[model samples]
Target: MHYRLICFDLDGTLVETAPEILDAVNDTLEQFDLPGVEQSQVERWIGHGTHELLVQALAYASGVEVQAVRAMPRLFAIGQAFDDHYARRCGTRGRLYPSVRETLYELREHGVRLAVVTNKESRYTQRVLSQHGLNTCFDRVVSGDTLPAKKPDPRGIEDCMRAFAVPPGRTLFVGDSSIDAATARRAGVAVWLLPYGYNMGQPIEACAPDRTIPSLASITDTASSSSSS
Candidate 1:
């Protein structure tokens, strides 16, 4: 195979975490006597890091315009509260996406290095992965809190490349968001996107990944065909 490493996005790509995330966000909102967000809105709010999500959610819930810099500190506190709640209740409603385990196993069998690059907090990400028995499947895991900068900055991808000792041309980044596409582009690696994952309510196809798959398992066939060509 031409690809030596495959990096995956955590939240929407490998796991369906919407239910738990929405629940946690709602719980935190309730504590503040704020109106809860709609499920669809929460879905769209994801993909960015936790702080960004919280800021947007708070702005939406309080009817405060997002441009208010004065409210940022309070929103950051609410975001931290949401993160705490999520950590306590993480994975309670989340599960591996269909075919995720099978695909990871197959890729591991083929000796392809695998890593997770996500905007989730490192400790929480570790807890969720361990609880779901996915910790062993990945050779390395990079969380949003793992570095000073998150996706779209190329730092996380650069870290992944360093961990795997793989060059950009030989690495494949699989994700479900424009953030991932941006990260791949910045890192100079090939990118594949999954249609079923979150893309901040935008059509993932518009991100123009090198390839798009309906599911993670489909990458096997796509990779095989790409190698042959």
Candidate 2:
């Protein structure tokens, strides 16, 4: 394939983590006597990291604006509670997307370096990757907290490209959201978005990613095309 390095987004991209994320959110909400949110809402709120999702949930439950949730004097305590709940719920119900493991192996076998750049916080990202047995597949992992800024800023993708010594033309970002598409665009790399992952309730096609892929399995075609050429 033309690409030397591939960076992935977590949550909706690599893992279907909304089920557990919903569980964690509701768990935290119940502790504070707040109404629980639905899985659909949680899925829609994903891609921004756990804290942001929790803020959205609290906002919805309390009929307060997201900014109000963020400004709540006890927001820190509430965030801490959410952290504990999410940590416990991290890997319990999450699963890798179709063809993810096989594709990761295929790419690795062909000398394609892999990395994960996720808006998910470091703790949740590590737990999910380890639970899915994907820890060793990546040459590097850059979580939301790893850098000063997260997705749409492109720092994570750029950092991975620099670490791999690969230029934008040789790098590809695979993800499931507009955030990922924007990040890759800003970094001058190609991005392929999956249709099934979270795109903030919008169609992935609307994001106008370089390619709107059906699944991770299609990535293997790159190797075949390279060989045939």
Identify the candidate with maximal TM-score.
2
Clashing pairs for model 2 are none
User: RMSD in angstroms, candidate 1?
Assistant: 1.7
Per-candidate TM equals 0.93, 0.96
What TM-score quantifies how close candidate 1 is to the native fold? 0.93
Candidate 2 structure quality by residue, lDDT tens digits, 70-142:
9999889988998899889888998999999999999999899999999889988999999999999999999
Best by lDDT: 2
Q: Against the unseen true structure, what C-alpha lDDT does each candidate score?
A: 0.87, 0.91
For model 1, the superposed segments whose C-alpha errors exceed 4 Å read 67-77
- Candidate 2: where are CA atoms >4 Å away? 223-229
Give lDDT for model 1: 0.87
Compose the digit string of candidate 1's lDDT tens values, residues 123-168.
7788879978999999989999989988888888899899879999
* Window of ten residues with lowest summed lDDT in model 2: 220-229
Error of 2 at 108 (Å): 0.4
